[model samples]
Target: MFDKVLIANRGEIALRILRACRELGIATVAVHSTADENAMHVRLADESVCIGPPPARDSYLNIPSLLAACEITGADAVHPGYGFLAENARFAEILGEHNITFIGPSPEHIRIMGDKIEAKKTAIRLGIPVVPGSPGAVRSGDEAARIAEEIGFPVLIKAAAGGGGRGMKVARTPADLAEALTTAQTEAKAAFGDDAVYLERYLAKPRHIEVQILGDGQGNAVHLGERDCSLQRRHQKLWEEALSPALNADQRHAIGTRVATAIADLGYSGAGTIEFLYENGEFFFIEMNTRLQVEHPVTESITGIDIVQEQIRIAAGAKLSFTQDDIVFSGHAIECRINAENPLTFTPSPGHIDSVHVPGGLGVRVDSGIYAGYTVPPYYDSLIAKLIVMGKSRNECLMRLRRALGEYVIEGVETTIPLFIDLLKDDDIIDGNYDIHWLENYLERRRQ
Candidate 1:
């Protein structure tokens, strides 16, 4: 086991990683920017370091400062909670070169999975189903047109290195392909510094589904289950639930087993998520998140497995303590990402939290870093907390989620709590009959 672990991020996830490390008897080093000088995680960590000024580029994302902090604190491992450098292959390699363990997958796997083109090819090689379209990047407008024709109308042009719905466009008909292609390429270059784009058949109403897996780099892995993350706005997931209301027991087992087997075959280590788009009872591979996902708590709530702890143990050369049969899924879990933003206009609302109140009951959990006087800086993400609730059934979980959301209060700044509360009243959401486009359409209807 590592003597001390340095957390290289901020916000609620930093606190999440800190708690995991503390439970394992590992000392913690919290790295923060000037804006987070009084943050909760920094205050609770065994040691703290001010990396740089408030800007993420000069601070949380600064590799040299992180290395210096590790060296100064004598930390042996680093835990990248979710964003920032979590999926950066070079960051993982540099830490490895400096003889510090990165509590994640190998750099090789990260590199391969980071590229959409290579990841699709790898998924196909592993017998995973993928949306049929261009086998590689489409270099010309004419080539994109050709592929779009073959794939049928309404194809999606996606950036090879894109995420969060950026650098993506959809051509609903042959006449729209040229503009869509050019705009996607332009956005791709600007957002990711890569003009490489690919085409795929766009399903009209697909649901976003992802499988969570853990590996020990010793040819051993297990799948906890899947999450239905179809709710989103501008490609950002707001609501997530485990034991998706869309899949049956047989379907769940089939997909989970396949994902676990595939990860084990690739010798993947630590925590990873294989995301897919599902429609008409078919699953198509979209991409793979090479690091832990923002919605990991829902998986943990259902499986009763500490994913972060497993990540540390794997990095420390521990074999998986359990096998596929030993794993069991229970009940249903739901997580609402409560962001510090205007509920109506969806604008960032960062400021001092005057008074904060979190609800607690059986199977309800709140992961947050803000206190009464904590000033939420404008330089970071607006996600203030995660509210998770579990129940013996999906219906019970939904009711619990409603009660929990009603009780969660963060004053002196607006939040998205009202949006979630309104959502729970809708028949579509209650019946779990929503697709990926449901939330956008719902919001549009509200605007009307």
Candidate 2:
């Protein structure tokens, strides 16, 4: 293992990576923006360095300063947790040029998978089912309209390089396609610096299921099964659970094995997630995230595997200790993202956290960085903590989660606790009979 690794992000994930390094006896350097001078992750890390000011472009996303911090701290490796520079190919390439290890996949894998359209093509070539619509990126509204008519009424205009629901628009009729295409392209350019857009057959009510894979640099790889991230509002996942309530045993196994083999063929390494859209009974590949996902705790909760440790070991060229057979997924696990935002408006509510009360007991795990006095910064992501709960069955897990969420108390700044509490109250969510639009509709009705 490396003597020390620099974590290039902030919030709960930074603390998550820090705990992993500590368990592996690896020292960690936490990098922070000037706004986060006294953040929990910084104080918890073995060492810390401030890269820039409050703004992300000047600070957290500042590649030069991040590399400089690693160089000055003499960190042997750097772990970009999920967002920020995690999927940046140039970032990984720079680390390689500096002789410092990047605790993720190679730049080639990141580049291919990071591009939405390219990943769809790769999935299509691999015989993986993809939403059939666009052959590739389309140039004009006229092209988008022709494709939409062929694909049927409802179609989605998606950015060729989009994620986190940034550059997407859905059109139900031919007239809407032209306007939606223009809007998607504009948003794509603003968000990703690329105006390219593609088309896809939009499944009105589909479940977002993702397969988590762990692979050594060599050809050895294994899938940790699937997580049901169907609960989302505006394409952002709100809650995630393992062993999707939608899939049967056969569907799960088929998707798992296929994703494992395909990525292994690509020579991918470390921890990565292969996301698919499942509607009715059919599954279609969406894209692949070439880094650890924020919702990874649910997979780890049930598998009895420390994914961060596994990711680190793989980065160090250490063989994965568990095989496909050894990967026995037990029980059910659920994660509720607790963010510094208003439940009613779903807007960012960044301020000081007056007090924090966490629940405890067997099977109840809370991954958080904020405490009583931490000032929630408005410049970064709204996520403050992640509450993960596991049980022997889905029903039991839901019940435990309900209890745990009730016990979770964050005083002062507004949080999504009320929203999550309302979510738990819904019979659809509790019974897992909901889709991506379930939460949004539910919230809408409640507001009305």
Candidate 3:
């Protein structure tokens, strides 16, 4: 076990990793930007270091400063909590060269899975079904048009290195393919510094389901069920739930086992998620997140597994604590990503939090870094907290989530709480009859 671990991120996830380290008798070092000098995680960590200015390029995303902090703190391992280098293969390789353990998967796996084209190829090789499209990246608009025609139109042009819906465009007909391909390539070049883009047959009204897997890097892995992350806006997940209301027992088991086995076969270690788009009782692989996901709490709630701790243990050469048979998933769990934004307009709300009250009860958990006086900086993501609730059934979980959202309060700044409150009452959300496009359509209807 590592004596000290440096957390290479901020916000609630930083605190989440800190708490896990404390429980495991591992000291934690928190690295923060100037804007987050007094962040909750920094205050709670065993030690803290200022990395750089508020800008992410000079701070959270700066690799040299992170390495310097680790050197100064004598951190034997680094835990990148979600974003900002968590999936960077070069970062993992750098840590390895420095003889410091990266509490995640190998750099090879990260490199392979980080690129959409290679990930899809790996999925196909592992017998995981993928959306039909071009065999590889199309070189020009003419080639893209040819691929779209062969795939029967309605194809999605996606960045090979994209995420969070940045370099993606959909073309429903041949006329739209050329422009869509060009725009996707431009966006991909700007966003990821890579002009490579691939095409895929877009599925309408698909439910986004992802299976969580933990591996020991030696061909041992286990799946902890799946999460329904269909509630999205602008390709960002807004709400997530475990024990997906969409899948039956047989479907869940089959998909879960297949993902676990494939990842283990590839010698993947630590925490990873295999995401799929499900429609008409078929699952098509979209991508794989090679690090801990933002919506991990819902999975933890149902499985009672400390994913962060497992990541650390795996990095320390520990075998998986349990096998597939030993794992038992419990009741339904739901997580609402509370963002500091206008509930209706969805604009970033960055300011001081005057007063706050987090609800607590059986099976309700609030993971946040904001306090009464914390100022939400506009330089980063708007997510402020995660409200996770679990219950014996999906109905009970929804009820608990509604009550919990009502009880959650944050003054001096607008939050997505109102949005969730309204959503809880909607027939579609309550009945779990929503898809990846459902929330956006609902919001659009309200705007009209």
Candidate 4:
């Protein structure tokens, strides 16, 4: 086991990793931007290093700063707890060159899965089901239009190398496709430095489901089941629940196994998530998240697994403790992503947090990077905390989550709390009858 691991992230995820390291008897070093000095992750870590100023490019996303921090702190490994450089293939290679473990998959895996076109090609080659659309990246709007005509109208134009909603546009008509293509290309170029964009048949309504997998380096892998993340805004996942109340066991096992086997055969290791779109009993591969997910706690709550700890062990060349047979899923788990944004306008709200009171209970877990008196800076992601609750049934879990949300009091900044509170009361959410567009329409309906 590594004596020390540097967390190349901030906020609740940083704290989450630090806490896991502590439990594993490993020392931790936290790298934060100047704006995050008062962050809870910094306070709880064994040691802290300031990478740079607030802008993510200079701090959290600064490759050199992160590597320097690792070297300066003598960290044996780096745990990129999602986002930033988590899926950057070059970063993984740099860590390998420095003889430091990158607690994720191999650089090659990240590269193959990082690019949308490449990911789709790989999936198709592996006989994995994929949504019908362009065969590869479209160089121009004309190309995108041609592909859209072939696939049918109402297609989605997406960046070939980005995720989390960036560089995605839906063209409902040929006229819209032309403009959307240009905008998508520009956005993709700015965000990923790659102007290449792709097209896909836009599903009118689908359930966003993802499978969790743990792969040991010895060519062994197991699926931890699925997560229902259909509750989203624009493309950001606002909430996630385990066991995908939408998919039956047969469908879950089939899709999960296929995704795991395909990726595992490609030499994937550590913890990763394979995201899929479920529509009309058919599952389609979308993309794979190559690092720890923000909603990992929900997976943990149901399986009694410490994902961060497992990531550490896996990085240290340890074999998986449990196999597919040993794994057991118990109860239901739900996660609400509490962002620093207006519940109504859905705009980012960043400022000082005057006060904070976290919820606690038997199955309630709050992963946060902010505390009372800590400022929610406007420089980064607006996410403040992830409220996770577990129970024997989805109904009980909903009650727990509702109570937990009520108990959480974050002052001095607008939040999506009211949004979740309202969502909880919706019959569609309560009945588990929702799609990716459900929240969008629901919010619209709420306004009118």
Task: State, as a TM-score between 0 and 1, how close model 4 is to the true structure.
Answer: 0.97
lDDT at 280, model 1: 95
User: With candidate 4 superimposed using the best TM-score fit, by how many Å does residue 203's alpha carbon deviate from the native?
Assistant: 0.8
TM-score of 2: 0.98
RMSD of each: 0.7, 1.0, 0.7, 1.4
Model 2 pairs whose backbones collide? none
Error of 1 at 165 (Å): 0.6
lDDT of 2 at 47: 95
Question: Candidate 1's residue-wise lDDT over 1-448, tens digit each?
Answer: 9999999999999999999999999999999999999999999999999999999999988999999999999999999989899999999999999999999999999999999999999999988889998999998989998889899989999999878888899999989999999999999999999999999999999999999999999999999999999999988999999989999999999988888999999999999999999999999999999888989999999988999999999999999988989878999999999998987678999998999999999999999999999999999889999999999999999999999988888999999999999999999999999999999999998989
TM-score of each: 0.99, 0.98, 0.99, 0.97
**What C-alpha lDDT, on a 0 to 100 scale, does residue 2 get in candidate 4?**
97
89-120 per-residue lDDT for model 2 (tens digits)? 99999999999999999999899988988999
Backbone clash total, candidate 3? 0
> What is the Å distance of residue 432 in model 3 from its true position?
0.6
Model 1 accuracy (lDDT, Cα): 0.94
Where does model 4 exceed 4 Å of error? none
